[model samples]
Target: MNNLDLIVVGGGITGAGILREAVRNGFRTLLIEQKDFAWGTSSRSSKLVHGGLRYLKEGHFGLTRESVKERERLIREAPGLVEPLEFRLPVYERRKPGRWTMGLGLALYDLISWKWNHRYMPRNEFLQNVPQVDPRGLVGGFSFSDAQVDDARLVMRLIKDAEMNGGKALNYTRVNKLLRNSSGKIEGVVTEDVETGEIKPFHAPCVINATGVWAENLHPSPEKNKHIRPLRGSHLIFPWELIPITTTVSFFNAQDGRALFAIPWEGSVLVGTTDIDHGNSLTDEPRITQGEAEYLINSLNHTFPGLKLSLNQAVSSFAGVRPVVSEGNVSADKESRDHVIWKDKGLVTVTGGKLTTFRVLAYDTLKACLDMLPHCNLDAISEPVFESRRSITLSHTVSETVLRSLWGRYGKETLTLLNESDEQDLETIPGTRTLWAEIKYAAKYEKIRHLDDLLLRRVRIGLLLSKGGKDYVGRIRSLCENVLPWDNERWELELKTYFMLWDSCYSPDAFQNFSR
Candidate 1:
């Protein structure tokens, strides 16, 4: 058995962060994911790297402070992945915490962010930015600075960087059982290769469970490990033409008082996020319920009364189960966004945090578990290594927008990807800024075992297009068939499986079952 210093389970942002830091500090670290990287809550986020403006209202100053600082740091460290975003919070007579009150919140938000492009937009100025918004009873709004990110790409890039620094990451592999020494102190893990059905055992001094909502399963005593209260958050995406908007609009739902965000994303408008207790089988993929679709549609209709957005206009929908920590009968929305790390008979489970604060969570998890490995040098743990600045000039034929997009997605690898691609791969997909070369690159290097992993997780053409971007399936297969080495039968079966999964797990129609 190959003994390792650390074994981080779950390939979400939290585990990725831990793996990066561990390897940077000279610890032999291994990260394993049951499916593709970022296939869980990480990829399905709202894709914002904000300081949790809502958290400030809930009086979580500590979380807000850490998040804002990390948010700014990420913006500077990974400018290619994180872009500055402007948000507008429209005020109405019926809405509580009216204009002036919200203005106070923005002031605090800026203070927390160290500094921000915070300003109050008068009704006319706001209307200019969001013309589709219903100007009736609208008392202007407050504009503030945050950021948006390619959530899935961020995870993949972090893992890539970790690998560059000597970390090992495996996708399509799972930890089938936990190993314990005779004394019952933590020893190692038993893993299964999901593809080859091979079982293997490895020794490690520390095993960190960062498996989000699924953390409960690995506990030796399942009865005592019942902290997770899975909250399902669902989102809807629409064509930009139908709901044109330049900035994110924050609205408070009249029905449940939940905050909703309708933002412009990937040349489309993304409106989402409903938080409710998930009372279903946790084994299957999460889906947006019919009530969630209606709720989001109604929230958008209320905010942009002129648009009258309907459920049918939704190009696609997605849902992710949050591994929130809670007890008793508290409302799901009210659960603390803070994370917790606790050691058990042999394993350490870390869960309950937001995407914006994943780095901090990783730091804390490492600090908590380091003492367990007495032989390890404490000084080895340090800050994560940020990508170094590099200058590259591209061909004049490549437009500035495309060049920037490529760098943002590929970072240092942009040059190699561009140099290897033909002219056809340089062009963007019809409806999205993603390029054909991205699909090819993922197939060749990103461990894409299935068509869904390529379209859905690798490039996001699946979520960005209607019917999960089926129109481009033939083009994609042609581009990546050589790299993926899929036979015609395998390709057909994978395509069929991809479509079935998408329709059942990521389509607006998936919500119809919850309508009644």
Candidate 2:
């Protein structure tokens, strides 16, 4: 690491992808994250490896095609990470798009991804809605193929792959300054470990600035604020038994045409996602607004008359900003999902683009950066070593029916996850598979410091469980007692600090009066 060829300044998907690609290319690389990996938008995504079916409405055919093909690659390259999910959109006369129109759109979507029509997923078709949702007054629905993935886990796996290929990653490390030579060319950066408060200077020939919403913070300009708009999109998680739709439910907001989704996740039902133009940085945690919660409940009620969900029913909720490139619209949801890469001197900044196409974005970024490289046998390199047969996991398990279910989310890594532990490691935590093993693994391997980092990103119990992981503070503290080197007083203080951090998500008055 003394002499580095490249340095990436973010641990999000983009940064992780760049580092992975760079290392595979045999570049001496250093990747540093201010907090934990996927601490920003990468962890806060809708958890879908999708092709942007809704974007097709806006005539974004190219985006859809690219996403579909990239999705195919993900299922192949990372079987344990990317999984196929069937999405069902119930067609009602009240809805604008009729059965035929929706069917035609899906058929075209199938055509775009015809290469793998038989291997991975089925083509879009009509199916009977699950009995949970009232099928009354419902026309035929359109079902299509997409994939679901654990965002944080995928980011971790990418970093793991990069590490396996000789890349240096430092968590709790902050890049305070971007260095440039006298010739006005970007060269390296100034970084510091937040815990040690130690500063260090690192040099790299090429730098990719994939800090998502924090791009402007690294290299700000007069128009940086206008360049990126941070939108706060929120979601509420509930017990899976409550949601009637077994398949991923694709429903539109009756009041507005915005797309909303309800997917099934680890023994719990996933419901969310109300997009608004406002936002807060990654440092400050965000919460779902009352209006947003009410809208979600009403969407469920309207689509499924038998079901009733109150705010109290919401086990937990989360909110994060989407760093979409500004497209003349103040509304974040209206902004284009396309990505933009900018190179000033030797620094390359990539912002925007959907989650499903991250690898492709990385490939494009690496090829472009190498092409722009002064000269280093760039053309001599043949193909990348990204694809490997090392992946090893399947959903088949002898435990409970839930084992198969959990394996789907965990992937080939699930086998390693299970084999790494004995009887003690099998103990599960709150919010689905928030096991003690996972907590330890996050610290030992995945770079976790504070309880917030574990609950929010590593385990996701913080967002999907009530009390924002306050219920599991004892579990974490007990582990800190045995495994982590901390005093009882320190453990108690960590628990308290975590609660206060969780409280920052919502206004004091809002949470105090926020009863169902």
Number of the top candidate by TM-score? 1
| Model 1, total clashes | 0
What's each prediction's TM-score?
0.95, 0.87
Model 1: lDDT of residue 68: 87
User: Candidate 1: deviation at residue 406, Å?
Assistant: 2.6
> lDDT of all predictions, in order shown?
0.83, 0.70
lDDT (tens digit, per residue) of candidate 1 on 1-516 = 265888999999999988887777677889999988999899989999988888888788888898888888788777767888888888777678787778888899888878967898888998887888778888788888789988888888889888987899999889998889888877888899998999988788889999988887876324364488889999999988898788888888887878899888888888889899999877788899878888888888887888877888888899998988886466777778888887875578898898888778877887787776544454533343356447775543577677766677777778777777788888888878788888888888887888888888889889889899888777888898778888999999999999988888888777564343
lDDT string, candidate 2, 70-92, tens digits: 88877765554576887777777
State, as a TM-score between 0 and 1, how close model 1 is to the true structure: 0.95
Error of 1 at 404 (Å): 3.2
Could you tell me the TM-score of candidate 2? Answer: 0.87
Instruction: Flag regions of model 2 displaced more than 4 Å.
Output: 115-128, 221-226, 279-283, 371-420, 427-436, 469-473, 480-482, 506-516
